[model samples]
Target: MATDPIEQFQISNWIPIEIGGLDFSFSNASAFMVVTAVSASAFLYLTTSSRGLVPGRLQSISEMTYEFIASMLREAAGSKGMRFFPLVFSLFVFILVANLLGVFPYFFTVTSHIIVTFALALLVVGTVIIYGFYKHGFGFLKLFVPEGVPGALVPLVVAIEIVSFLSRPVSLSVRLFANMLAGHITLKVFAGFVTTLSAFGLAGAAGAVLPLAMTIAITALEVLVAFLQAYVFAVLTCMYLNDAVNPSH
Candidate 1:
């Protein structure tokens, strides 16, 4: 009867399917992920379909997004890393759209799940590892060893670096997942308070005012956060790619 904030996060099976004991059913989360990807793709295509001398509003926004990610990769990873523009851009768009979509009622937040975020993080790390070894061969190991460390402390520093490097995916995934999860949960709690307080008479209506205001403010903040988290993810990915490109640092 009462609203449960946590209920929103529960994954429910939409179209069940099982083969070879594997549960690969389509779910609300999966549907939303598809929607996010399709929506982003459609937006880009529609916005850029007509190449006008003077850009329209949608075209301007699309070009701005492209330039923004391009600038970020150039700053973090240099021009050589521009080859990864597609990967980084798609990632940023997907996360950004998914996050913003989740802010709407009845939309599932895919990034809030550890599995989804971890997969994305692992993809970035995996690309770094694969490309690093492919490009630099044994030199990739140098990423774990700094140049200025004392000879005596080299082993300790390398050990620390190794731990830190291995923890990248975990940290990256958890950062996105935790932020989305906490933000949505806090929002739901405040929103629930507004709903609960509305049942009272005049006093109840007055009580709902503060929580309603807080919810509105948090919604605005969450919109900013959606873009920020996506940008942060893209920047970090570029930085990691830079290491793979030049392991000497």
Candidate 2:
């Protein structure tokens, strides 16, 4: 029987590798997270180790990545957003690396899991809440009130806006997770068609080629999707931060 490609996404079981009745087994997701962090560190180290005026290829790529995030922040969140350049840039690179790295053979996509994405989303939303409250005091509550609305309707309007504000993290996280999950599953399903069709005759062989082609094409597209997904995640973060810093926007 053929394996279900979707089942390949399962999180590894917790083993009883116990220390004083506490179970801790290295999971596939955890391994990927470690790998993602190490890979990011190594990339940064190698790229910046030579502080020469003349640029190297790796250094150029790293610089470009940083500038890209900076540009996005300035464009989306404005000059006030520069204060967050470091955080936004780091986030963009980290997520980009984790996503692109998962495309390799025998590797897991940490971002495909809801737990990981939701955690990240929570951090973004949490930062917004904390920063907004600290910066604006009780005026942060005014985020839910539109400027042009009548005082009579303010209560009902605020209630709706509050729900919308709370939904940001879920919507943000689910967007990335759902896209990555769907992309990988679609790739796997197309690849599987090649296997199933090859068992038939020449027409089957002929037909099998199409799915193989599609799989290859989608793989390339998924690479683009990976980058775009990372971009989307970072941009949304900037937008959320903007709403925090300048809540009236």
Candidate number achieving the greatest TM-score relative to the actual structure: 1
Error of 1 at 230 (Å): 0.5
lDDT (10s digit) by residue, model 2, range 80-190: 878888788877877888889877755789898998899999998998999999999988877888899988999999899999989999998999899889988888888
Once fitted onto the true fold, the runs of candidate 1 whose alpha carbons sit more than 4 angstroms away are: none
* True-structure RMSD for candidate 2: 2.2
TM-score of 1: 0.98
Q: How far out, in Å, is residue 77 in model 1?
A: 1.2
lDDT values for all models: 0.93, 0.86
Count of backbone clashes, every candidate in sequence: 0, 0
lDDT of 1 by residue, 1-249 (tens): 347888888899999989999999999998999999999999999999998789999999999999999999998888888888899999999999999999997789989999999999999999999999999999999999999888999999999999999999999999999989999998999999999999888899899999999999999988988988998899899999999888998
Q: Cα lDDT for residue 69, model 1?
A: 95
Q: Any residue pairs clashing in model 1, and if so which?
A: none
